[model samples]
Target: MQQIDIDNHHLNFQLELQYARARQRQRRRNIILIVFAIMSIFYVFIQPNQYGNKQNQIQYSQTNGTNGAINITETNSTLLQIQKHFEILEKLLISQFQGKWTDTQLTSNELAEANFYKTSYQNRFQIQLHLKLIEGQFLEDYYNQFSFYLNSSQLVLPLEDNNFVFENVRGSYRRSSVYENDQSSLEIFANLTMRLNNINMDSDTQDDIGIELDVRYTLDSETFSFNCNLNIINIDSKAIIYSTIVSVLGVIQFISCLKLMKDFINENRMASQFSLIIFVFLMIYDGYLGIVHFFLALQSEYFLTPAFLELVLFFFLELKLAKHIWQERFINLQDNLNLRRELYRFHLKFYLLAIVVVLLLYYLIYYNVFLIAMNLYLLPQIIHVAYKGQYVEFDKIFVFGLLSTRLFIPIYYRGCPYNILHAQVSYLTVTIIILLFAAQVVLYYYQCKIGPRFFLPKWLRPKSHEYFIEQPIDGECAICISQLTEMPTESQLDNKFIAKIISQNQNKLMETPCGHHFHSICLTKWMNVKLNCPTCRSVLPPLI
Candidate 1:
């Protein structure tokens, strides 16, 4: 009678083990299916921002004219529109001039007017400039005052200084170096003597004539020498470079977010949706920013307003992303309701304070404050992780990349005050992150084992039975009715385990605090989803 009972028990155990394995397989399939569905939905709904931007451009052009100029109404005069264009051109010229020139750089708001034209060969470039009057009101005739032209040729000019006398203007140009391509720099110094016929050349009467001007530029001296360190990169080439990098990052992060979404859905984790939403917003903003850069490169005046708006949006989104990330750490611990509530309450207060800061302060100050807050919030987590000395999570690596640069750069800049080293360090850190993220994307795509393994220290490598809870007595799992350590050969179950399942206890099973033993895979999945013991529905203790 005892042998018969034992045989029946073994048969039932075998059936239960098969069922548990089958359930895990089904769950995996369901997860994959859900992920696919979500991806499809995003594809359908979240069209790339560029497409809409293009459509808007087309509609705008059609509405305005074939020439793509804005139609001015009585309220919006042509002069007002012209003034707006001049303002944008002034900013661009000032920025480019200050960045490239070495001599007699434009003082703040000193560039009165600027325009550029490309020759038929496309290699020849001409830039026109007019300096702002020091005294007297800017008049409609201001456009006619002190016009100067800078010319560059694709043909490399001789590296010698020479004096040339044109019909109306006499000048000396020294071509020290020529810009060969987008990657190269151009160094040239030029001085010109302008015969200002429109201006009353008399020094005392210059203001009366509506012209305040210094007409002579010297090649040998700094008078009228607009410092020349011109590295002329085409806007299109710059746009391509920036757009390519941003596009690559956007694609990789989009994939990462999709993976995260899948995990959240599979585990039925709703608490982290706020973070996901912020992440999505950031991705959208990044896409729009890239589009803005491309349009700006094309010299589209229409996108200028949008570009500033995008910058402000980026600042806000970055702050929100940090906030959501901080909130998610605690809320993700589904078992700890009290802790989650406290964290949520804290986050609410922080958010209100942040809003006040955002409203009261400028974006630069807000950016610095956001960085400081992020570092402060992440410091405790970093310390905890270091103290625990456990496996380094994949998300932690991502967060580290995001926060580390922000944390150190601001501190360095604060101490040093606008040092060139700050810029170099920022660039170096960004380049490293880009390379690492690219590598991460490729490794993740290939399912490389080394991706996660290399990030963790040897001591932190998981041990056998690390996740398996030993129970006082053995029984079937309520989630998956599988017998534990009661078999003719425990090793026989090894082949049935899924890829994620670690058969750590010599093919033995896991147990919960409630005393029910289960297949390690079954209990782990159940605990991950609900944080409860399967049989008695008791909240499980938090794992390290």
Candidate 2:
């Protein structure tokens, strides 16, 4: 009965140990699953907010005259409208000056009598016109003064000269010498120039000349030109702030990456170290571009052209770096040199393709399209990498954080016009990222709890049970396979074991170049004979 009880007790102990291990494994798995679920939910709910925020930003940019808001189609439409109005005004001016008047047109007598010019020198007309007849009121400032010289008659009549006058006009104008030599043309030009110039000379003079009729009958019939001058001061201010903030953040990220790389190097984690180097280079490049853009923005209101190009480069570099980091952190753990090389080449090709796409979009579609596409592409890649369990290193987490921060910039810029929409979206996306990071931290803590094993601290390994055995082998060492004739006493065994094997164990045990163990005497002889491990034939360490 006592023997049966002992056997049962042993069986129960084994079962308890097994149960504990199973429980530990289950707990670890459950924690991982929970963290993954949280992250998935966060991404699913937050992604819509990202898209909505971007869309709101686009709408705001368009409505508020921001650089990226207006689409190429809309901008082209505006340009066409201005061009059409300009063409109409050009036609009207030609008809009025040439005196080609139908019932719908004004005759040369009517035009001259309307004071379209200040004076007429022979055929040369010096028109100082306060003609309010211009159709497009948006072009009033440009058409405020006029000077017409007839090149056909070699006549020079300087009617009015101002900074914004005809002297600044670089383009060709029709010249007529007949007007200068002919009395009818001279009288007509003089009458037109005087009438146009007299209207705004004085209020009293305008009233005496019946200004309302002159303005209505003469000036009102003339066409007006349109010119658009977009003020970029506000955009410039915002861009400076944006670029500065991004650059500072980029620099901080780069520094953090460098520190992480140093840590990897210290741990002899070559793969992570290499991956971090790529990220560091990319971040430095981005920082440089940001600084350059900040300076450029100060000089020109529309610096986004060059800034967008930099952004394209940044996107490509960021993608390549991210892929390399992910691969280093999670995949291909066999130290597969070929796989690493292939991944590098693949990412290089991908970056090249991304660059081409960005350029094509900028040239063919719209400049702002590059920014949108970059964020869109990056967000997916980040989420995909995260979902794949690809981020083992903290550097990768930091990189993802920086990438996530980029989403906020467009949101802030969009807030200028669609404040409510951007605010809600920003709040949602931020909340999701925060929750996801928190879940990750919890998962990491649990992982550490489950297994505290680390790559370092060789001395901290559990001492082998064989080391405490009282009986020493009387025959040849199991590893050396040499004959032993003399047997030492227990005290001698203890002294030799402690002194020759343990204290001087570093020299007695040969560690191969690959870090596998071997008896030194046997390994040295084997290396001399074969230059490889006796057991595995892996390259042996060099003799001292």
Candidate 3:
């Protein structure tokens, strides 16, 4: 019987070892499957949505030389290319028009004047210039002088045809003159004006806009160069008024973002602080674009690099912020650890894809999809808040407000025409948000200064004496079983004074209706978990 029992025990031990090994193998297989699943999802989603060939490709080629020749070739949107062609056409027409003005001048005189009839349809402009160029710096000096002139220049278009206008036109000029390489080139830069539309006018057009252009013919080369950086600006008076309002609102929004960032920092919310910092940067970039749009002559393309950087930064911030919200709200969900690990992997892939998108697609509108995706990721948190009927975090409120500013208001202006309704809706939304923010600030201050009782209405305020007592029945608290009269010897106050406060004001003692007393802090902590008196197990109202 003993030998049979030993053999049975050996069999049982071998079976148990086999079962343990099988379980370990199963766990490893599950881990492998999870990793494979995460990678597969990443490849499927992230790989397919790469920037396609539809974007404008900018390439640079340099030849081997001391003064390397740089060539830029692009396969871009035909529409944009056509737009550039039209701009070149307008420039050619303007140059021809100015040549017409030059023809009427005396070619022999060092100083001559050309006067043209002011066609009723078009503006009659005079060209005059005083030129002095130093030796060995003809090209650069002439370009610099002309660039300065274009900065102050403005285009006035006829009411009928407003296309092909350049305002705040400024840039370096490309010179193809015989005098370009000369020791000195005395060239006077001149402005050109022409009537592009209604060349065949009925009964002679009336209003006239005049320009004065001065040019000096150089001896080294009998040629000159003229060009302006073309950026369209067609803001009407109504649009200007609306833009002013939008600017004011943008300032307010920036202020609000900064305040929230400060709060996040103070509260030690690192993730939130990082997100708000990005928001502040984005607002500042928008402000810069706004200035370039409405007040400056710089081309929108000039700001593309910074704008692209901002877009990439924004996507990164959104990813981080989404992950932060998810972890905070989804801690109770099953498989949370695996979900968080996968989330990091997904976000890493997304960050790479976002950089690619911003580089390939310069349009800011493309990034709107990212914002939508971020919000979708946060939908669970939104739903949870809705179910609980609680206030959202202030960061969320600020984010939505900023998004509205971008989506509803034409904050960048960009010369796109907008109706009065756009202005009205933007103004209303921003005003309401500002008011709400102000109220929240006030409430937060009130909460900090006053106690928790102030959170409830006067009628709902619980009578403290019913649950609190001036003295403990025993020397120790019934809940913690610690001496209630124990005081810290912090050298700032007398022990007697501390004892007097505890005795007279029921300082640290709280008594339940069941006639048992506990430390106020201990009882409150206990009630938070189980809304009942610890000593008697009696039901009580939940702590607010």
Candidate 4:
């Protein structure tokens, strides 16, 4: 009953050990699952804001008006009248330069003179026109000229009761007027005519001509104010191409945030999930900035905000994730003081400090500095650790991952002239992915391969024993196990029969490499081959 109880106890001990190991495995798996769930939740809840409905709000205020409606009326009508007159001047200049005939024919010298006049007029007119219209300066010189044209009936000025009108040489007309009451203001009427010029009239002839007039009146004074402008609307399609590229890259950046989370998982699941949450929030903020950019392209404000935010967030998350992964693999506070001492003595602090300095330099100056320093500092450590048989799997993976990253460097840094923003973001994303992948590979290898190799050197070698077996008179010597020997000790003689059998059977005696005697020869052989002192396989050297 006692024996059976002891056997059952031993069986239970083995089972308990197995259960503990299984539990540890389960715990690790759970940690991974928790991280994955967190990341998935972040993506689901935060990703939609990046791509859904966008809003644009525009607010404008006009000067020289009591009512908001009055402001719009005055501003739009004045701008339109000026635009019409500018168009007329431009057509007249083009016709005169090309010697196109209206009812009045011009002599060649007159045409040449008009051409010269047109060039000079356009040059000076554009400069003054920009100042007057854009700078909001309706100078007296400009207004008097419009008044002269209207007074001569070459151009008819509209009614001064807040109405504005423009008639083109093609007989098309645009009329706009505003009305105000004691309570509010309203647009009394607005009409515009657009005409298609006859191409067959003269292919080379310039036909469109008109006068631009700007008018203002003080309601209390009832005095008319006017300014003349030469309007030139030069529309180019190239600006649209640049805006479209920016918009497309913004969309791509939002999508890349989700991909970044996946890369985080491949790095270190637990810490990566935390980083993913932060990045998701950053993506939402960036998306908001993108929306602002789209709506307010004309303002050019808030342009740098998103880029600044992105750069900050990217750097922060990258460092945090790297630290997390590295800590898991290399840092162990609970390790023996002596072991830590040895590692420190090996200049681990120097390496770590170098890493920190490089990272800081990257943030302060240039990213390539970090890359160069990391390569220079880390490659030697990897080789050293690998040669020590530490974290073999991790070392192999790290080597490969680093190689891949180096290969990707050019790709990351290649700035596509047409897609500058996209290229920069892509470079950062790729860099983060490579770093995370390398870190993970190192962690996994350390956990499995390197950790197991950490055993005491003494346990791996052999020890010596002192006992020796006597040989039987009629049987064999234990050393040769073939030649018979007569030597026998008193105890051996007392158990001579058993001793003789043991000796003849080649079973007992041992000898150390130093010529010391022992009872177990096989054990001595094992000790010698393992580099322990069979009598001492120490630096004292083997004894013959």
Off by over 4 Å in 4: 1-18, 21-31, 34-38, 41-46, 50-366, 376-378, 381-411, 414-544
For candidate 2, the TM-score is 0.30
CA RMSD per model (angstroms): 18.2, 26.4, 21.1, 23.8
Clashes of 4: 11
1-544 per-residue lDDT for model 4 (tens digits): 9999999999899799879986896686567546644644444345432211223211111221212222123456755564444433333322221111111121111110112012122122220111111111221111011111110111234423222342221111112111211133222211112122322222323333223334343333343332332222211122244344444453344344334434546642233112222223233333333343333332222333333333333334333344453343333344557545754643464356546544554363224334433333233444333223222223332234223323332333332212212112133434554565466446444533433233335455234233344442343434433433333332332223333433553454544445544434333333322323334333212211
Sort order, lDDT high to low = 1, 3, 2, 4
lDDT, residue 438, model 2? 52
lDDT of candidate 2 over 202-258, digit per residue (tens): 121122122112111123345323221111122344445655665555554555555
Candidate 3's C-alpha lDDT?
0.37
**In TM-score terms, which candidate is top?**
1
TM-score of each: 0.37, 0.30, 0.30, 0.25
For candidate 1, the lDDT comes to 0.37
Off by over 4 Å in 3: 1-194, 197-299, 305-309, 312-315, 325-440, 447-506, 509-542
Error of 4 at 205 (Å): 43
The sequence of per-residue lDDT tens digits that candidate 1 reaches over residues 192-223 is 42211222222211211111123444333444
In candidate 3, position 487 carries an lDDT of 30
